[model samples]
Target: MKKLTSRIDKEKLLLAVAAPLLALVAALVVTALVILATGKNPFPAFNDMLSYGSASDSQVYILNKATTYYLAGIAVAIGFRMNLFNIGVDGQYRLAAFLAAVVGGALSLPGIVQIPVIILVAMLVGAVWSAIAGILKVTRGVSEVISTIMLNAIATAIIAYLLQPERLGQLDEAGTLVSTKPLPESSWFFTLDMGPAGQLWGFIVVAVVVGVAYWFTLGRTRFGFDLRAVGQSESAAAASGANVKKMIVTSMIISGAVAGLVGMPTLLNDSHQFDNSFPLGLGFTGIAIALLGRNHPVGVALAALLWGYLERTTGHFEVIGYDKEILGVIQGVIVLCVVIAYELVRRYGLKRQQQRVGAELAAQAAKTDTEVTA
Candidate 1:
């Protein structure tokens, strides 16, 4: 029995990791089969993706991508923990990015001051925007899901209207795309001198700091406990002296502020300008990362890294005459697999616990019978 329990424990741990591993493997296998069916050599394509993904430049690109995803993932996960479906992250991030770009473009301060100012503005804008949803939910009993979704549409329209050269016009004179003027070089994110890799040191530092802060806030803070209590049962929490309304609003604000940071990697490090085509889909992608990571900060970080790696590698697919859309298929498959695996593992764990309790009860009964007979 001891050996059985030990084996089960090890198996559970293995399953926890293996689920994601298996998902990746399955995605690759399916991709390869698709390539073969198309009469392309999967070996060469896979090799190219692998090589490019590991290259110095690709590593830096992955790091930048990971940073964005990490911030967005944490934002989504925060809402998840509070039982709030904040689909407005896209809108929140867009508004924040626009505000940050505008602030950076208008500012003439030193790098230290200018950059921080821009980031702060972004966070404030995102927080305020998200708070609207929370307020509606608290005061009017509106479902966050409905409110956030509507807010996303409104945000998209606002960005579209603002991107025009006439209204909030900041783009270059030459007709190119919907964009803002480039921020001053002084306000750009600090890059690590990694030769051709082009690492963004600021992103790495910020990601680590945010991760640690988030962990502590959720695990140790009184506010965090109140938020979790509200999430578990709003009535019970309210009865226990917790302010459910305040918790809801607070959770949304924090989630949006975290999401607002997502644009930093692009605005401060990569582009320094707001563009409509500058990967606005990251907010939605963060949802997948949050789900895949099970809303855990460390897990979310790992999930973001995996996503970044896959995204960077997917560019190589274009070289092999394959559409980069293959990455989408892979992502979908992996997310599905991870969700299924998590459910299975959870059920298995519950079953094990039940069995352990049953065994203990049976042993107690047997001992009692023996004692009575003697």
Candidate 2:
């Protein structure tokens, strides 16, 4: 009986883990079909992504890209856990990075003080920006999605204004691209040694720390429980004295603070300045990654790597006369399939759990009846 119970427990665990993997497999099948429809062999495309993405140079790229993606995913996940839709991370990070760059360039402090100051400025800006939506939601019942979307527009205008030559920016040496003044070397991040790959972003450490913190806080903290309770049902959480309004505002601020760090990898390591050409759309991409990872920190890490690897290696398709857009198709398919597959498996697991309890109760009743007869 003990062995059977152990086996059943293991089976349950296996099913829980297998659901996402099965979804990924389904996603591949659908992606392959899409590739076929485009008159390209899916195998070669996938092969190129796998092989090239493992190269030293590609590894560096993947690591850096994943770092930023991981941050963005975490930022989005914070709000997701509270059933909040924070659609303004794009604006939040961009505005934060721009302001940080402006401050870092103007200051002449030591690296220790300067870097922290820059980062703190970014977090403060991001938190304030996100708090606007949260405040509106709690006080006036504004939809966060709408408010955030509008905030994005506002942020864009702010960035554009700040980037003006007469404002916080000037043209590059080439007199074409407009960007903020470059920061002093003290504000720049150190790079990790990677031999032929040259170097990897030091901000990768920050990303790891963020992921670990996210996992620990959510899995072990009382605040996390209240946040989740509110997410599951705001009415029930309020009835249980979870302070639903406070959770909403606190979660949004936390989410935005994390979002503020999303651009640090690129800003401190690659560009050393905030430019108009900085990567955009990472905020929206994070939504798919968060969904694909099921909002688990470890899962988000893997999902980030997968996403970055796909992005880094997809150029191989262009080398072989194939369209690079196929990568997007595969990525989208993966997210969709994973969501559906997980839902199905969740329902199945619930049913199996019910069955197990019923059988155990029935066995207990039969044993009692036999003992009574004896």
Over 1-374, each residue of candidate 1 has an lDDT whose tens digit, in order, gives 67667867887788778777767677778778877787778888778778888888888788888888998999999999999988889889888999789878888999999988998999998999999999999999999999988998998888888878887655566766767777999999888888767765577788889999989998999988888888889999999999888999999999989888888888898888998767778889999999988888999999999899888988667776887777887788889878877787678777877887688779989999999999
Model 1, residue pairs in steric clash: none
**Candidate 2: tens digits of C-alpha lDDT, residues 100-133:** 9999999999999999999999999999999999
Per-residue lDDT of 272 in model 2: 90
* lDDT of all predictions: 0.86, 0.90
Report the poorest 10 consecutive residues by lDDT, candidate 1: 169-178
Per-candidate TM vs. native?
0.91, 0.96
What does the lDDT read for residue 277 in candidate 1?
67
TM-score of 1: 0.91
